[model samples]
Target: MAWFDEVAKFNTPQLRLAHITDCHLFCDIDGEYFAVNTAKHFSSALTHMAQQPLDAVIFGGDLTQDHSFESYLLFAQLIADSPLTCPVFWVPGNHDEISLMQRISGGQIKSAKRLIASGFDILLVNSKGPTPAGWVSEQHINELSEVLAASQQPAVVFCHHNPLPINGYLDKHMLENGPQLLNVLHNSGLVNHLFHGHVHNDYQFKFRSVDILSTPASSVQFTKHSIDWQQQNMGASYRLITLERLNTAEPLCVKSELIWLNE
Candidate 1:
């Protein structure tokens, strides 16, 4: 219960979540990143996400491209204007400011690290490092181990950075101590999936038994496996994930798909 908030759990059999990430919004409402209007796309994503009923929304980070407090305000404002009623759990990306984000989180927007919904334990992990790369400190790993041990429910880990090399331009910024984090997840045997952002592309693969998935940016689309910064015309996209009980012995079955907008 240390990491989980004191919110009531959903009594439903399935948990559905909308994972939106890498908005890279700026302080200015009309700001653009690589000629893509981040605020506009983010607003569009919110509108699209609001159309569906979800248990929660995982804002996977890179919330601010300008690193201004006003950028965070704009993010909160967009959510406030949307029809999303479920809890929004967020983590920080390399370009984000934790202090600024904390100032803007309240009400439906939360800073809670863990959530219990639909028979699963969802954990939010901060993989932000000093550089653009990611790091999972021993302290955080220890905390994660303790949290997983405390619960018998199947676990899902959410972080801002991918813990493994994606073989893309963003691979250089993959989590530095990724193996350590994977070790914890592998050892736990309770973790079913590891979700993250920052790759700016839709990616999925498995590390041993655990599923590792990345959500695309709500702002710009990045070409996968490109050595340089390459843009694609695919437009903004987000991931929708559903977790359901299979049986007492089998882990929660994960079903995911990408929702594209303004293409």
Candidate 2:
């Protein structure tokens, strides 16, 4: 699943996307064992990304600490307040409370929806359902069917959980219906890339015909797929995606490289 990576490049023929996820911002960084100033780390990361030309920024979810209202408002403001002039899209997570986010002020939900409508048709692809378990039901699958059917530009999807299991144990936390979801995506005939969050470790893999990608959480990078939580690295980080659409009738080519906050 090695995507074409160019250390020096900017924008794309049709879209310059910035994919970030799992901010999980806390009011303070002094948690018990983990001291993660998620907001500040995210702010610094945005400082770098905002300066670059972008078609839109797509956020895979987990924007707050335990889905707090203030955290969501603050995160929404963080994006709106950024120097970026492009649209922004969001997909919810198990750590997010959708209703609270929908009510947050200053275009939290509106801005995301506008991006979905204007640019590449986005599928929210809720990965938070069955809260305790990782799963995307058949209903969401039907919605994806219609969404991809209606998309004009290449479609980009964001979800809280990865659909492809990277390892055995974490496979227990992947979309329970991952096989089905992937099958539909491969058949949808329009999806160009599928970006995900949840593993807390950055990885790229191929499942069927689509490129399956996962990003490190903005607040933590877990130890590579182990049941021992004690072994997790839990560092602060995020990613900067550089997309290049070749000047051909073919679909766009997207390659994302990491910009770690701890760096």
lDDT per residue as tens, model 1, 42-153: 9988888888878889999999999888899999998898877788879899999878887998899887887766567788887988899999777778888887888877
Tens digit of lDDT per residue, candidate 2, span 144-241?
A: 67656765556666677888777745566677777788788888876757888877787888877888888887666667756655324354556666
Clashing pairs in 2: none
Query: lDDT score, residue 248, model 1?
Result: 52
Residue 45 local lDDT, model 1 = 85
Backbone atom clashes (below 3 Å) for every candidate? 0, 0
Worst 10 residues of 2 by lDDT: 1-10
Point out where model 2 deviates above 4 Å.
1-13, 28-33, 80-85, 108-120, 168-170, 231-235, 243-248
lDDT of candidate 2 at residue 262, scale 0 to 100: 54
Model 1 steric clash total: 0
Off by over 4 Å in 1: 1-8, 246-250
In terms of lDDT, model 1 sits at 0.86
